[model samples]
Target: MKRRFNSIAPSTLGLALAAALPCLASSTAANAAPAAQNETSAPPADSRRYSARGRGDRRDKWIHRWAPVRNMWEFGIYGGVWFPSKHLELFGPTMSGSGSGNQRLNTVAPDVGLRAAYFPLRFLGVEIEGGVMPTQTRSSDVSATAWALRAHVIGQLGLWSVTPFILAGTGLVGMQSASPPRGIGNDQDVAIHFGAGVKVFINRWVMLRLDVRDVVSNRAGVGEGLTSSPEILLGLSFTLRPKKKKARPRDDDRDGDRIVDKDDFCIDVYGPPPRGCPQVCIDDNDGDGLDNTEDTCIDDPETRNGFEDGDGCPDEVPPELSEIAGIMEGIQFDTDKDNIKSTSKPNIDNAAAVMKKYPSIRVRVVGHTDSQGAYKHNIDLSQRRAASVKRAMVEQGVEDSRIETAGVGPDQPIDTNETADGRAKNRRIEFQILEGAASKTVKKRGKKPPKDELPVEPTPEPKPDPTPEPAADAAKPVDPVAP
Candidate 1:
């Protein structure tokens, strides 16, 4: 049984190796899984790929999505078998005779290999390696040994804790066997090897690797020419350099919007719930004056009322109420005349219509004049003219109580009084729609207009001559004639 086992057929070993590979791969996957790291070490965005961080810059990250290792050095020890494609024919002394002979060698033999690699960059490395194995030209005959040494360039790609690499190298190979009636000397030659394999990191410090190499040598002490031998090795490697430390995104974004954190007013949150950090959904739109954080009504458009309209909302003013300034060009008057002009009718009609439409409106109809007349006379004229205009509007069905009249004389001219055009422009009328209807600035509550500004009362009608007590009333006229 020992003799049978030692001479195991080549076909049997091939079947055994093929059956064992999948078992090794499955075992490696099961044991090589990495533990989750702290949140500080996790990438900022994707869970798989390295975090790209800022915009546009995509270089300088791990080559593998799941492999976290960067630049480092690795040292590994490997043990495997070298199988010859064709039987190696060795020229050596025959065990049965005292003469030299040749015999084909085909057998499974064990080999030991060692490797040292330097990874200067992420995906590239250089390795120096050597291996030795004892050999036999004939299965039960005299045994010999072969040695190989190489310097290889390694190119690697890693994915999800597994790194696969390919190697190409040129090296030296030697085979020697001595034990016979005619001892065989050493056969040495230059050799070239190329193959590929994989490495699985069980952790940062330890990894498992498997390599396959095909070595072509011109000088195998064989009677036949060159020999092509393939070798397979599995190794466990240790890293000499420490694992790299990953960085987490900074806490500078307090609002979770990715804006400068210090610039945010409503820090630590995004409004309307389900907020913060992982997603930034807020939008400025630039429609309102303020940013979304400061806005109370975030979606409402600004009123543009020239107020603090930045709250992303329009001012709440009634549709019927609007400033009388600049609309319909304000009321205008002829020089020294307080009577409503035909051109002014359209404006008056609009004002009356506004009042009729909304009963809450109270208006001040003010009269102004040029500086041509005496100050006091102008004051009185402006007053009467304003009163007369009020009466005309009262006739047009506006409520007298809703209207207030004022005469500023030349005190408030809208234009220069030195020219005719200025004088004409100066003598004008204005309808100030009181703010009690909407905003607070138009008029103050419960405050009366100045006493001096109230319109003068109209002259009283004379009573019918005291109903004559005829005779007695006639005596007074007669007495003057008689006396």
Candidate 2:
């Protein structure tokens, strides 16, 4: 039984695949182009030159476009053969005689039916049907005739134009057969059916269909049999009402910004900045005080001052500041102090040199601490650390006031400080542009500056202290006993 079932499995799967081909083809075609007639409209001559400018724009529109066949109802008809696989038994009193010999009679049978269906949802529908067949067997010793009335509820799945269906229901089987004497019997039974088929839309009002159905039934005293074997059917289906026209695709890009404006907060502009929408026409995607349209160092804001042409990008590497800062881990510092460790100096210097090169660009050096310390202590510590960094830059020839300092105590840890590693990771310093000095320089130059002169160092301050002692230290007594 298992082998027989397996043998038919491939054919059954093939039929299912064939039935689904139409739906797959339709979906592919729908996605390949716009549902609208002008899916591939050509741009006007003037717009062609600015095509690159609007790439972000077109993509925004495509995302919001609607599909053409979203909500439409379809109706159709189907027909098939019914091959009976078992016999109907007729019982009567004493076939020959109780003492002489006992006998029983049975007859072979066949059946046929009609099919109708309606779709209430995409890829699904319900079907109602009825049919008839004969159950007479040809023999001199005995003869029988059977008639059945069946009503089944069918379920259908649409794959493009093809639809596959299954059905199950209860019906009455009336049997009549001849032996030593004529006899009749009526029994209640059940029928189960499954089928696969395809529908071809001829127009808005009609469709052509082809299908094959297999049916199995249970008859009292005759066991179970294939009441309806496979049958090839061809039929026509008439639509009861005209379907509504599909809506045109929506334009997803809401903002004129180059980015595809999808669920973007900056609905009017495109933003390349992570978690932000572009608000201005300027192309500064990272919001690092450097506009990508003008900054050569768009990825590294620190290098913005080292480049000329107000494009906040770097042109040359400073010998003293060759080390790269780890933005992900942040700048490490000494315990309870704003002073960056000697190991981190190279990275800080690199950043400072970049700032010095762009004299006009100023940076905000922010200090953060782990939550282990008191809030006030952490705040003071963070501020002191920020001040220390600024002082170091000033000592390295950066303008005294060009660097802004701030302390955010244990408030913004990138990781939870409940663990040792996380606390260590949270103690850090970061550089942010307070004002775009590169943009200012470009504006002052009146025109784009030479790329070679991009590394314009800030005018050096004379003997300025890079680090300032806390005001509390200055007021403290040299010795506690002296006070």
Candidate 2 off by > 4 Å: 1-80, 89-113, 140-159, 163-186, 219-233, 245-483
* Total backbone clashes of candidate 2, pairs 3 or more residues apart or in separate chains: 22
Error of 1 at 165 (Å): 2.3
- lDDT of candidates 1 onward, in order: 0.60, 0.51
Best by lDDT: 1
Clashes of each: 1, 22
Query: Which predicted model would earn the best TM-score?
Result: 1
Residues 1-483, model 2: lDDT tens digits: 999999999999999998777557545544443332243233334433222323443322222221112234444444444444433222333443334222333222344455555555545555555544444433234444444455555455543333445555555544455444333333334555556666665443566767566555543243544344344566777644333223221222333333332333333333433422422334455455445545555565433322232454444433422332224134667665556778767766777777766566655667778875334445567777778877877888888887766667677778877799898778877665434333443322122334675787889878978998689658855776765
Q: What are the root-mean-square deviations of the candidates from the true structure over C-alphas?
A: 38.5, 31.6
